[model samples]
Structures are given as C-alpha cells and as structure tokens.
Target: MTDDVQAVHQPSDLRTVIMTGASSGIGAKAAATLAEGGAHVVVVGRNTARTKEVASRIGGTAHVADFDRLDEVRDLAQRLLDENPRIDVLANNAGGLVSHRSETTDGFERTLQSNHLAPFLLTRLLLPRIVESAGRVVSTSSTANLFGRVRLDDLNWRKRPWAGGWLAYGTSKLLTNMFISQLAARSPIQAYAFHPGFVSTSFGSDSASMRVLNTLTGGSYGISADAGAVPLATLSGPTTVGVPSGTYFDQLKPYGRQAPQAKDRILAEVVWETSSRLVSIPSDL
Candidate 1:
C-alpha cells in the first residue's frame, strides 16, 4: 500500500475530530498529528485560505469561523454536526491574547469570548454528538490559569480597570478549566484541561511582558508548537480512557495545585451558569 493510501486509511474507524484555531500554531500541530494518526480532522479557523491549506495537508476538511464571535461558533457547531455528527474528539485549542480590551459583536470581552465562551457554546451545541460517540472533549488551558481569580462580580471586567491582556487571557483560561470541572461533574461526556508549558511558539510574543523578556533574555524559554501539541493529542486519543475527567495536565501528566478556587464547586457551577446565559446555551446540554 502507498503512504498516501495509508495516510487516508490510517484511523479508518476514527470517523471525525474537531480542532479550533487550527490554521496555525499549536492547534495546527495538533490537527496534523491527529490527521497523520488517521483521524478525519475538521479544522476550524478564521482564514479560509490558511485553513484550507492546513486541512488539505492533513487530508481533512476546513471550516472557517472566527472564535471571537459566539454566533459564528454556534453556526460552526451546527454545520459540523450536519456534516458529520459523530465527532470522536473536540479539541478546543484556539486561543491567544488580544491587543486591547475589546468586545465582540455579541458584546463579550474579546479574549474571554474567544477562549471561554466560544468553546463553551461550541461544546454545548455539540454535547449530544460527543455523548453519542462517547468521546472526549479536550480543552487547552494554560499555566497562566494559576494566576486567574475568575471575578464573577466583574465577569465582563466592567468594574475593574482592564489591567492588561494577560489579565483577561489568564482569566479566560481559568474559566475554561472551571467549565471542564463543572461539565465533568454533571455530564457523561468526559472533559479535560491541559497546559502545554511555554513552547517556542508565538504565544505571549506580542505582549509587553514578553517584549521585555525578549529584550532582556533573548526570548529563550520556549519550545516548538509541535512539542506543545504532543500532550494535547495524547489526551484526545483513545489511550486516555479511564483517566479521571476534568483534571488539569501539564505536558501529559497531571499538574497544577488545584487551588482552593479551582476546586470550588460553587464557582464552577456559577461560571457555567453565567457562561450558558452569555452564550444562550441550553441548560440540559
């Protein structure tokens, strides 16, 4: 058999996988790895050409949709289910820092909407399909989650002066983790959050702190996006069956202090409730 044929046939039974922000960076790497392993990846991104390029390279399909928009995410989820209902894995990997404290057309904070609310709605919309496949939902959190407080009083950051991009970005990731824990507790479908560590990717590169770090230390502490995608792919794979759901991992192993706030069941419920209200997701989902 030819390599091309093998690539096409390799996870022949693993029908579908969905990866967000898959046009570039760690998300793209995860899509490639999963595709090479024989999963039919549905690459979601903002750029049609870039998304198609990556999708073509992986012998997969591309769906262009911006994560910063909740309506777009809802449309993407519906289209994905209409095309292929039984997605075996949903990788919520699309994330990054926004340059300013902006709001989406839907009126949510840009970073918070993209990193947390978008995925939350996407997951809820697709929850039935994932449950049907008995598949895993893998979310890409960050080491920065450790620094977040998830201020419910200022869920939209309305009262507090927007401290910085990291503040919003970190809070979004922490919300992602909180959502995972809450989902795991209530639903049959398993969910997980993970930190890939500081890979030599474009993450944090556009930030003021990173600019200073780059200036002072030559921007040394980084690993390739390929390295960062490894553990993400593993958790999304079938090998992770039986592992406890809703736990956080760093580089494929369990990680983080599970800070008192992180473990707060009430907080997780509140976060999910607020998330559902903001995104208009069905409570049952």
Candidate 2:
C-alpha cells in the first residue's frame, strides 16, 4: 500500500471488499452501500481523483490503476495483497464499451482486455486469499451477452472485422459469465455474474451516438445507477442468500437467460484455459 492511500479503520470482523470501478456508476454506488453496511471497502478505479473521492466519502481505502495496461493490474493486485489480510468479496465491476476497435499495450483487443482479461488476471492472483477467506466473486455482466459469440481462434479479434465494438463488448461479457461458471466448477470459491440492466450510466460514453441517446432519453431509457447497483450489493453479501455458485443473474433473479456459448461447460473450460494462457496464469488455478 502507498503512503498516500487513505485507510479507514473498521472492525476486524467486517468483510473486506475490493470494488473495482468504484469511481463511478454502479460500482461507486455499490461500494458506498457496502461501506455503509460495515464492510472494509477497497476502492479501485482508473481515475485517481475520482477514486480517492469515493474512498474518502465512504471512509474506505483507494487505489488507482488503469485496466488497459496489464502491468497496472499486476501492481494493483500486489498492493491489494500486501495491504489486506483477507479479501471477502471481489466485485469485478470495472469495464466499459469501446466504440472503436483498438488494441491495448498488452496486445489484446481493448474491449476484451479491459472487460475480461484484466479482471480475470486480478481474480486469479487473489484466488488463494479469497479461497482462504471462503470469499465470493461477483461480476457485473450484461444481457448484451445474448448476442455474443466467442471464437477461441480469434480471441484477439485479429482476424475478424469489428462490428463497431458491440460484438466485442458482448463477447467479453459472455467470457465473464463463462469464467464465473468455470471458476465455480473448478474451485470452492463462490462465483457469480449478473446483468445490471440498462443502466443510465456513462458505460458507452466513448461513442458519440450513445452520448446523444443518453442526453436525449435521460433516466427514462433505463434504471438509475443506484437501482442497477442493488443486485451487485445484494450478491456481494453472505453466501446464505441462496444464490448458487456459477449463477448468472438478470438483476436480482437467478438463472438469467444466457447465450448458448455462455452455458456450455466444455466451452467454458476451454475459455478458462485460453484466458489463463493469455494472461499467463495457471489454468488450474
């Protein structure tokens, strides 16, 4: 942990939550809710000022790292491991919709790397501590996953033309669902993915059309960010809530409709293996 990172003093028994994307939208709201409920929240975001602001408001610790770079993700993980004795819940809530096709410094498609690969790496690196704490992993997925198609051969989008990035975004969410399912199957840690509904957030603010639509429609088009955050905060709670491991939720409802590829166990296993290889982690971990 850095000296400048604000640390909130909380009860030792409080659950330690690491909330990514806590600088804004559903993630920020959910992190506040968790903190109010007496959890020790670790706020992670790409924007330093925004991340620290949220953390300061919630009396939580803040760390900033851009998901576009794998090195930053690794550094964030190490800082997390070094500071927290246990991580009870990891809310993989940091992701966005890229409007154009681009590759990160890590050499993976920007959307796929930011939304899936980065979270994948963070979870795997923290697996041991999370398992030791008998923790849970809750990811923010989407109904857009219904349109996703994952091709193992073209995971990097090197061979296919980008369909304006929605396809890539959907594919990343599908990978999220599959990763949760496979993680639950292979490990004792409870893992879940959920669709937060069409939230009125800056999710697709990278696109000009989306910005215009959001401006014109406002909150009428979708639920508020706090409303969309309810499911995430709920699922982040105790395991006794009866949500089974590997469940994909549409808001609060379990077993939400998922794409065929998202539910295929064999394909999920392959995805797990391939993602592990891509991120240079152990497949079996």
Candidate 3:
C-alpha cells in the first residue's frame, strides 16, 4: 500500500467537518487525520474518484464540486448544509495556481475564484450551521502572503499581463488573509489563516514556477503533508482556547503581519461584497 494511505485516528465528539480540496495534499492528510480522530469528515474536491477514495478509506463521506466553478461551490455548500446542519468545522483548503492567466465559468480570475471567492461564498452559505454548532472556520494561507502584492486595479490581471503563476497565487493568499480579518469582525465563527509551512505537495510539482522553486530549495524547505496538517487539525480541536481570530499561524506558532495588502479593509470589504453578489443565500444566512 502507498504511504499516503496510512491510518490515522478519528474524531470522537467532533462529528462534522467540511474539508475542501480533500483529494490530495495537506487537505487530504488533514481529512484522514480528522477522520481518524473520529470526526465525520465531508471531503470535497473537483475529482470525484480520488475524493471518494480518500473518503472511503477514511470512513467519511465525499462530495465532488469544483471551487473554480462558483455555481458548483454554492450548490455544494447548500447541499452540505441541507444534509447536515450540524457541521462543526469548515476547512477552506481547496486552491490552485494556474501556470497561465485564466478565468472560471463565472468570469472571475481562476485563482481568485477558487482560493478567495469560493471559500468566501461557501463560508457565508454554511455559516449559519457552523455558528449554530459553535464551530470554527479555518482557511489555508501561505508564507507566500508575505511577498504578495495585491493589484487592486488589475485584480483579474486584465490590465497587467500574466507575469507568473506565483504572483497571482500569492495575491490570492493575501486576499484570504484580508477576508479572514473581516470575518473575525463580522462572523461569530472563529476565523483564521495558517501557513502550513512550505508543504511538499503535488501543487508545487504541477506548476513550472513552483517546480523551479522547489528544485532551487533542494526540497529541503518543504514540510510533509501530515506535518502541515498538525496545526490545522489543532484549530479544529475542542480543547484549543484563546485562539485569536484573524491571526496567522505556522505549526502551532503564531505568525504575524502577513503583508500590508492583507490588512486593507477596503479591499477585503470589496471582495466580500463582490462575492456576496455572486452567491444566493438567505438574508441572515
């Protein structure tokens, strides 16, 4: 058997967790670990077969929906909420870095749509259930946010030409941070952004720019997917306390000052408003 199929503990009392990008990488590892911890994890991904495989092996349910597709993400959230109103955790982990400039069916930038908009929409859609259950919302961020620059004028890369995938990817992370801050202020759900610490995942191998970065670093800088899952899993635990909402973390250690762009409330609100218009949710939901 592959090493990736290693057994982990399941969540006992933590019965419900909605994990996106559960097909592979840190998301998959986190889903397995949480399932082993006894949580009835709902795995969401673009690929049905792989996500189903992970869910089946972990004794959890799988839901297939592409985050890059806003309508799909919206539908996924509604269906998930309908299936189980007791969802206790929302792990917004699905994201990607397209090598070239692209847009989703919603006409939004692919990275922004997947990493920011979809998560934003899904969280808003499922927030009532999460808050009803007094659950936490954990979104994945990266150290790349440190170097990210938000091009507000050209958020879609319409004005500026495609520089590289990393630039757009980094900006998306920054947007995530900004959104988290707004959530902390507005939502009852504890919101946070975490750096999984240079994860060694297929994402890097799949992108030419990341491949070069990985090779230059001799792969020494990357952490195992399980290692990255440690801190994420911690946030989902019941014993965790005093976790400052909107804070950034790296392996249980609190990291700070992601980037100037990440603190732009105006940008965050703009993104939030734009996202709200894209998805249809009940007035208080």
The numbered model that scores best in TM-score is 2
Query: Could you arrange the candidates by TM-score from highest to lowest?
Result: 2, 1, 3
Question: Quick one: RMSD of model 2?
Answer: 2.0
lDDT of 2 by residue, 151-193 (tens): 9989888787787788888999999999999989989989999
Model 3 stretches with alpha carbons more than 4 Å out: 1-14, 213-221, 278-285
RMSD of 1: 4.9
Candidate 2 TM-score over all chains jointly: 0.95
Q: For model 1, what is the C-alpha lDDT against the true structure? A: 0.80
TM-scores, all candidates, are 0.91, 0.95, 0.88
Worst 10 residues of 1 by lDDT: 1-10
> lDDT for model 2, on a 0 to 1 scale?
0.89
lDDT of each: 0.80, 0.89, 0.78
Looking at model 1, residue 82 earns an lDDT score of 74
Full candidate order by lDDT, most accurate first: 2, 1, 3
